[model samples]
Target: MTIILAHRGSAGTHPENTMESFVAAEQFGADGIELDVHLTLDGDIAVIHDTTVDRTTDGNGRVTDFTMEELKKFKANYHYKHFFKKTARIPSLKEVFEWMKGNNLICNIELKNNELPYEGLEEKVISLIKEYKYEKRIVISSFNHYSLVYIVNNWPEIETAPLYSDLLYKPWEYANSLNSKGIHPKLKSVSDTIIKTTMENGISVRPYTVNKERDIKRLLQINCSAIITDFPEKAVKLKRK
Candidate 1:
């Protein structure tokens, strides 16, 4: 089946990365949820996209600039204040894992360390997964292949994948070299040929930010393993058709 992973937890409809958005994604029937994580000043793994909380939250500072307590002070729904009624705060990775206590949803945790990496990030995330015993349900992804390599090298049991923004030469081969089971490529880079090649090589091809209904239909038609979309409800409904 083509798994539908809500990008940043139904980002287009709710405040991205907030617990509210995550709940919305689950209610929308997403097969999985994709989120980004950054190390905060106090060493907590915060769930926000930018290096800073400026765009998503009411605060104006880098995520790394604030402690977990400081980051929690800003409302995550600041951007959608008028359109949405309820409010949420940026959640820690540990909080997110705790939220998944009873849910069986696949969680794709993207480490936002391609640039301005936090030291010991891999170990930080690994310990959390170990604590939760979610080796089967969690997938660690990053644009920085080195991070993925580090994860595999240290915790051989954990699942890891590469998140690339560009089309590469033999993407499946590259993933195999890094001991990855899949590749998260930008949507524009996915095609029938690429999907076929990846499938034949025994690797999965899951593209990111695929929101449009037409694109969702196209990828489903080609039998891509999964799609990372901002609106999981729409895509999952389309896949049903």
Candidate 2:
């Protein structure tokens, strides 16, 4: 079966990367949740996309420019403020880990370091997963192959995948060379040949941001390993049919 992972925890319905979003994903019976992480100025991990909070939050500044304490003060639902009356703030990695520990769900942790490399970020994230004993339940992905390389070198047991939006020369070969368990490419970049080649090499081909019922059916027809989507409810229902 093609597993469905809630991209940023059902981002289409709830505020992306918020606790409510994650909870809603779990409630919708998604197999896992995909979230982004960035290192804060105080050396803590915050779960929000982008190098800055200007788009998603009421505050205006880079994510790394503030400490975790300072970031928690800014409401994360600024963009959804007109529609969503509830409140949500930027969550720490620890907070997310704590909530996930009680659930029987998996999490894909995307290291948001391609634009701004966060030194020791892999270690910090791995340390938290270790603390929660979530090694088997986690998948690490990044656009920065170098970051994934560093992660695989330091912690060989952790699972890491490469995230790319553009077409590659030979993605499966490159992922295999780096000992990546899986390759995450944009849904648009994947094709029958890419899926076959990846499966031939014993590497999983899980693509991202796949919305629309027709696309989901197409990927499922090709027997994809997983589909990462903004609406897990729709994907999950379609997968069942």
Candidate 3:
């Protein structure tokens, strides 16, 4: 069976990366929740998808410019404020881990340092994972392959996967070179044949942002390792059927 990982926590219906969203995803029966993290000026790991708060929040500044305390002041619900009655706030990685203590859902934390190159991000994330004793329940992914490499070299117990959007030649081989346990690619960049070959080589393949009904059914039919989608409720129902 294919696992359904809520993309940014059922982002199609919730303020992305908020605790409200993550909780809703777990209730929706997702096997896991995928989120992004950036280091704040205060050295706290804040869970958000963009380097700038302008798109997701009412604030207009770089995420790194604000301390976690300042970042939480802005409602993280700008994207879905009209739909949700209560305002959502940006959750710290520690807060998320605390919430995870009560659930069995896996977490795929994508290090959002590809563009900004956040110093010590891997160390901070690994430290938190260790602190929470979630070493077996977390998968750290990143577009910055170097960050993944750093995790692979320093903390091999923590699983890692490389995230890429462009076409690559024999990605499983590339993952093997990085000592990554999986590959997270753009949906269009994969096929059943590619997924099978990659898994055969001992690398899991999980495509991102997959929401369409037909696409979800196809992946489930072929038993793709997992899919990161904005519609976990719909995908979980499809899988159940």
Supply candidate 3's per-residue lDDT for 187: 95
**TM-scores, in order shown?**
0.98, 0.97, 0.98
Candidate 1 C-alpha lDDT tens digits along 44-123: 99999999888888889899989999999999999999988887899999999999996999999999998887998889
Residues 1-241, model 2: lDDT tens digits: 7889999998989899999889989998899999999999999999999899999999999999999999999999888888888998899989999998789888999999989979889889999999999999999999999989898998888999999998887888889888899999998887878887887778888898999899999988888889899999999889888
Candidate with better lDDT, 2 vs 3: 3
- lDDT (0 to 1) per candidate: 0.91, 0.91, 0.93
How are the candidates ranked when ordered by lDDT, highest leading? 3, 1, 2
| The best candidate in terms of lDDT | 3
Off by over 4 Å in 2: none
Which residue pairs in model 2 clash with each other? none
Ten-residue stretch with the least lDDT total in model 2: 192-201
RMSD of 2: 1.0
